[model samples]
Target: MTPEIVEISFKGNKRVPYFNPKEIKVKPGDWVIVEAEKGIDLGQVNKVGRLVALFEIKGDPKNIIRRAVDEDLAKLKENRKEEALAFTVAREKIKKHNLNMKLVDVEYQFDRN
Candidate 1:
């Protein structure tokens, strides 16, 4: 049977379950956009199968908006560069203020929010 829900993995290894409400066919390793709290977000398909048994969803499972296209992929690449720059800047600022904390990764929302 086609899986009603699939697992999507984002940066930092964050994973969430989303349903193909529009019946969009997706497979593992395919990048996809999904509904998010603020707006749409992007992630890669990590697993495809019944997931309700595995995940304790806090609310309704978000829908898979669509598979990522070439343009979306290009934008994601740009987002990564921006995120890295932001990370470096933050680390420098932390060091400048003599803050005793490690600045690890910086993530930019897919929409650059």
Candidate 2:
């Protein structure tokens, strides 16, 4: 049988495709752990189903590492909070400096640098 395909959303409006081994059940909006370039990262399942082909995707699909655990969820929440706080601070600074450019988005890097 062919493995099912799943698309998950990552940070910065990025979506990646992964292969579902059919071991764990995941649906849309479900948080899952997926293999990353450096380490495992969290992903929210956006789409799932068998696909004959996809557009502009390179290489084979990866497997879902596992469903995200409580700690993972908590960490995700914390990161989001930090992102919001940073955005607020940056906006305040921009206003103080009277910058005309509009702030679009902010992304928190895992390196913690």
In terms of TM-score, which candidate is strongest? Answer: 1
Report, for all candidates in order, the number of backbone clashes: 0, 0
Residues 62-93, model 2: lDDT tens digits:
77888988988888888888999999999999
Question: Per-residue lDDT tens digits of candidate 1, residues 20-85?
Answer: 877788888999998887888999999877644466767777889999999998999999999889
lDDT of 2: 0.79
Worst 10 residues of 2 by lDDT: 48-57
Alpha-carbon RMSD, candidate 1: 2.4
Worst 10 residues of 1 by lDDT: 49-58
- Can you tell me which runs of candidate 1 are displaced by over 4 Å? 1-3, 51-55
Model 1 has an lDDT value of 0.86
Model 2 C-alpha RMSD to native: 3.5
**lDDT: which candidate is best?**
1
